[model samples]
Target: ASHGTVHPDNEDWTCFEQSASLDIKSFFGFESTVEKIAMKQYTSNIKKGKEIIEYYLKQLEEEGITFVPRWTPPVACKSESSTSHTRRPVSPAINIPDSATKEGLNNKEILNTSSSPSEPTAGTPDDKLDADYIKRYLGDLTPMQESCLIRLRQWLQETHKGKIPKDEHILRFLRARDFNIDKAREILCQSLTWRKQHQVDYILDTWNPPQVLQDYYAGGWHHHDKDGRPLYVLRLGQMDTKGLVRALGEEALLRYVLSINEEGLRRCEENTKVFGRPISSWTCLVDLEGLNMRHLWRPGVKALLRIIEVVEANYPETLGRLLILRAPRVFPVLWTLVSPFIDDNTRKKFLIYAGNDYQGPGGLLDYIDKEIIPDFLGGECMCEVPEGGLVPKSLYRTAEELENEDIKLWTETIYQSASVFKGAPHEVLIQIVDASSVITWDFDVCKGDIVFNIFHSKRAPQPPKKDSLGAHSITSPGGNNVQLIDKVWQLGRDYSMVESPLICKEGESVQGSHVTRWPGFYILQWKFHSMPACATTNLPRVDDVLASLQVSSHKCKVMYYTEVIGSEDFRGSMTSLESSHSGFSQLSAATTSSSQSHSSSMISR
Candidate 1:
């Protein structure tokens, strides 16, 4: 609406702009032009007015305010008691959703909720703006912020068909993105998709940690913090990060970490009810007493960074605070590698204490209850967290085994089963980009005897152009085998044997690795092992007769898995380079430590 009014004495309908100084006496000189401008302005103002009104309505809904019809009649009902007591009308809990009614109950009710960890809750408690927690960490939202939350929830509901996350969860994402609806919705939708794909909703009931993790993982949930937030203690310094990565591989470790986060979210909801306040995030205390260079193993660090990236993307604003105690001199290097991936708001929550700094004033006691502090940190309470030690090399799995195990978590086995005929061999081509890269294989001989060989070629082999159905066919024999090497190629000229052929018997399992001497294409071949014509004699012994029968079958079956790892991340993961023709010796613990030390030096530089 225009601010200036038409002069009473002006018959030409002259108008002056109130804020503009250079306006003519008759700004609206023509009636048609004035009407056109007025109509355009009216349309824009109407749209703006509608948006403002919608925003106000959303704010009212958020505050639990609803306008009932004035013509509605009062209900006639019998009171619980016959006494003349006033029956005051009670307003629905302000800012509380229907799903949040079950939370923030007494301690006994919290215990009951804990009995079913996987059971879906109505909703988490809404941390009202009046709470001090809201004013301190999660600032009180303005009307615009509330509007963003409302828009985000509606967007999710339209896209997601499953149970919608509570408003609090949606609000956390909003705050994480600084109330930017587009950014917050992007990450939130991605997280929801990830949760659905991984079946993370039922992780508590479905996932069972392996025994190694149960005995060796150095982190666990402790008591609540001073602000009623759940507390988690991690003894990172004492943990063998290399051992865990090697033992479990990156995917398994990632899944374990994800489960921990899911469990933490559950605990947060429970604490919210028990504390009678909104506890949306958890507090973590990390003890870095035994930190050293060994923890900087390349593969381990890579795994940690991947886990951090995932957590930061999906679980934003879930870490209320992070306390670092007994920070070692080497901590700076690790921090340099990790801190860049953390969110700025999350980084602000971190409090660092070097050496015995935590023991003095303004330390652990300020945030955690004195009696609840873990005994390992000089407090009387004994923490149930494991004192993780080095995992025995005997428990470590081969690279191929680890890869298969990791794949199984997200899908089916990576291993493929193939039939090896007497003439047609099953071959797989692997391209190595760097020399000293480790190529590892694990295969089981499911039928007759077979021979495994590794060959390196400067030029890639062209696979057979067509599939033929026979034992002597150039392509797949039993719909599985594939022969890659050409018959016209000479071994000495076209390719070289990188490892000696190893003959494996029926029902035997073989696992081996070879360090490549040159970067090129490597083919792993499983060939049928035929016995000599004269080896079996007539009227032979029982074992000889059985072997003759097996050889006569002319077909062998093998299930195998293979993986190539960069030399930098190899980390001496394999115990032996059992078939190396390049004079490469067995990979040992000392070699692993040396590689990690070199990598750590590079990081520091």
Candidate 2:
């Protein structure tokens, strides 16, 4: 806290807000009343500052002091079929479509156009990247965001050693983290690692969803929605989840979904060209016509949860809308089972329609143009989407086989295992080089109750000299050994928590994330449920979990994996995205180091 600041004559106005000293009750006469109203009206003007600037610009145009630039393709005209925005969102006060065809805006014409604009304009690109050009072509973004994005991209180009993601791809992460370069970079790095590890980038070329998925997955892309966003229709209720999993297996299923997302990204690019506008995301219409108990297979549900995790982490803000129509009474049960894993931004897009409600104003009609609504939904359009068929049990491997394979694959990953005990917590130390990088963890509470927390320290915590004892390490009978956790950590003085404590139940696998706001050492701690009185002494070691959950009286067990991601990429050249916008805002709070735990504990994926 800085104190003893000096103030010059006019500095009083700069240092102390006049609003803080105003008193409405001190009106001594009619002059005071007038002053009160004047102040009220004056304050109101502050709210209209942006509008006033827009109005002033309009006035400037009227007065012939300023003139707007005209946008044109490098060629006198485009190819007959090229989709281009006729109206642009450059004025900041008005949203004009660059061009509109009955077909829709896909946001691709600007980037994919064969002829450069000599000078970029709204919905157009140029050979050279410029901030104003980006503002007019892509979405509106704050200068800070532009800088953060550029820095992140530059860092990636210089340091990352693998394939580089596109600027649009990087921007999505930046936007997801409210343009916090460190946070966004961390997220991107992790996703890139996951992609590389899973060979996700090649999915579009290598993945082949078996005939079973092609014939019975019951999902396909249709025409664009009214907003020019590409629309996808899914007969979720009619589709067989168990069948797909059996046919493809979890990894294959995950890979297939990744391919769909990859396809979606490509489609979104193509759609931008077709729509002649900025179409960053697609719309999903899910028809839950026949969802039931059979769809609730535990293995299938687990697979779905894993899929959600992969999608949420890699593809943020890709789904513009999720319109769930014709949901049944059992929908809640299914929603409850999988909703916990859904990101809040994605969850907000879900609009559930029960019975025939989708035909009304706040339902499908609100998103989809009525004329294009599929025939099954009581509309005239013929939906080519498949009517799914059932899959035979022969496609499924035995449950025991799947379980064995799952455990085998899980053990092969670079994850750590530890036993938790009452009072003692399992803690992992992560050191971050860049502030705002993300720290992520995936863990399963195999037994007992546990609490999870993450704290940050400016300096690495050293074992206390006052204890007069050396550090402790133990080896287990199974040849697995781990160090004992230091139990007496002071919360604020030594290390302040960056994330709130998370309470996890037994048998649950939890995945969570946090963005580091500053470069420092972070501690992720998992503690067993302990008696309040036994909280401060020596806690149990990681070997206890390896020894046997049964050996400890307060037995608790956890299998965990953690990683740190920085904000950079693996590529040789950096292509700065240049184009246009309406507005970009700073997020109001920290990214919260969360991909998000749950909308609630059990129901949101």
Candidate 3:
């Protein structure tokens, strides 16, 4: 029996079963008709299964679903593999928008692909030609010029910030084709000509320093010092004087001078021959009297005494009264030497003899009696003694109270007479020195002679000379003698004495001869002898002295002692008085008195 299943559609199999008589017998022999029926049934089920699969596949195709089998044959296994080949599919072309196409065209590629006359390329001969052309034309131009052309090209770009015409690019390009640096610079300068004209006009219109007299004055021409410092010279008295008249008008000058003092106006009239001039009526007489009283007289008196001690050390023969000449010339020269020191007819008689050749002699006396005496002895006068002599302040309550009509007349008469004569009369000059017990000579101008000569008296100790070994040797002073500190100490002591009233009063008569003495001349003489050498040396420098008195930092007082014998000690006592007045709290009474005595002894020695 055949074991293979038969299909239900195989009609031939049924027929074959009936036709094969031998097969039926064989079939009935082991497995009868039932076994054959079973085989046929199995074959029919297989055929039905195949038909159902085919129907489902057809339905899926109609519904647009693809059916793929799980197992697939390799390419090598396919029959068409040796005869056919596979290839990738080509992509479709993209359709660009019209706006994008237009933009691309407008951009116009700067890199030229064609080997044409206009194209630029690295390998092209035209590139070589263009470079060669640039080398030939711009080789002579500086780096600055080359940079400027490059900047100019950048400025011509459409995106540039300036408002140059679009056609400027074409013009620049044409110029570059045949460039010349000098011509380019010339064109640039021409473009700025209008600007230069506007600048010139602006400068001229705004210029200053106008042409006028006042402008010249303000510009610092007339009254400037040599180094351009500002200077103003004020005229004090007799403004109608030539100097004043030239600077200010005659009327203004006269008015200014008269305003200083009514006495000045009167003096101008009396001494018209002396002060009055051809061009102007007035003269400039610096008010030196106040300056003398304040600076030179009071302080100078103290310095004069110190100077006398130093002078006496060398010139032992020089009398003590000789130092009195250092007193101021104006007051002393009048009272002590020139005119009589009496008030009544004595002064008038002297003036009458003195002014004989000039105007009425009696007129001189009248002028003195009225103007000169009142002015000198007035309350406005200020006086102080140096080293405590008979100070005017101590003699009377005030200068006004101290006024002696006789002394005033005497002083005025002498001043008026002296003023008439250019120099002091010979008789008067002699009396001044004689009273001070000093002999004087008029050397040089006779105006600068002080009563004592400190510089002449003291000689600086000699220094050692070199020995044979070429080393200098000095002699040391013995322990018994005082050791001097410095030359300044010596100089200080000398200068201080010269400033004392006694010395200055004496020195003034001898040196100036222009001054006469007052009644207390002997007191000043004694005071000079009493000032201590150490105290003199300890006094301040002249500059400080001037400054102190001017600022009132140093108060000056004059104490009087009647007895001439102890007057030197009295003057010595004034050193303490000055220290006290100066507000030196450290000063003790013992130290003060001791220092005063010590200072006086040093001067006496």
Q: Using Cα atoms with residue i matched to residue i, what is each candidate's TM-score against the true structure?
A: 0.50, 0.49, 0.14
lDDT agreement of model 3 with the native: 0.24
Candidate 2, poorest ten consecutive residues by summed lDDT: 570-579
Q: What pairs collide in candidate 1? A: 104-273
- Ten residues in sequence with the least summed lDDT for candidate 1: 85-94
Local distance difference test, per candidate? 0.65, 0.60, 0.24
CA displacement after TM-score superposition, residue 477 of candidate 2 (Å) = 27
Error of 1 at 475 (Å): 35
- lDDT of each residue in 1-605, candidate 3, tens digit only: 21211212211111001101123345446665654575456445534543554466466657865523323246445442222111110011111222323233211121111233354223321212312322322223222233344334333343433332211222233243233334543443333342244332233234332222111111111121221112111211111121111222222322222222222222322332232221101221111121122221211232223333322221121110100111222222222222222222212222111112212332322222222211222413121211111122112223253254332333233221110011111111111212112221221111221222211113332322223111101111110111112234454453223223323222121222111111112111111122234344455667744643432221111111111112223223223221101111122223224422111100100
Better lDDT candidate (2, 3): 2
| lDDT by residue for model 1 (72-148), tens | 12665454222121111111111322222443433223212321335542343222311232333234554445446
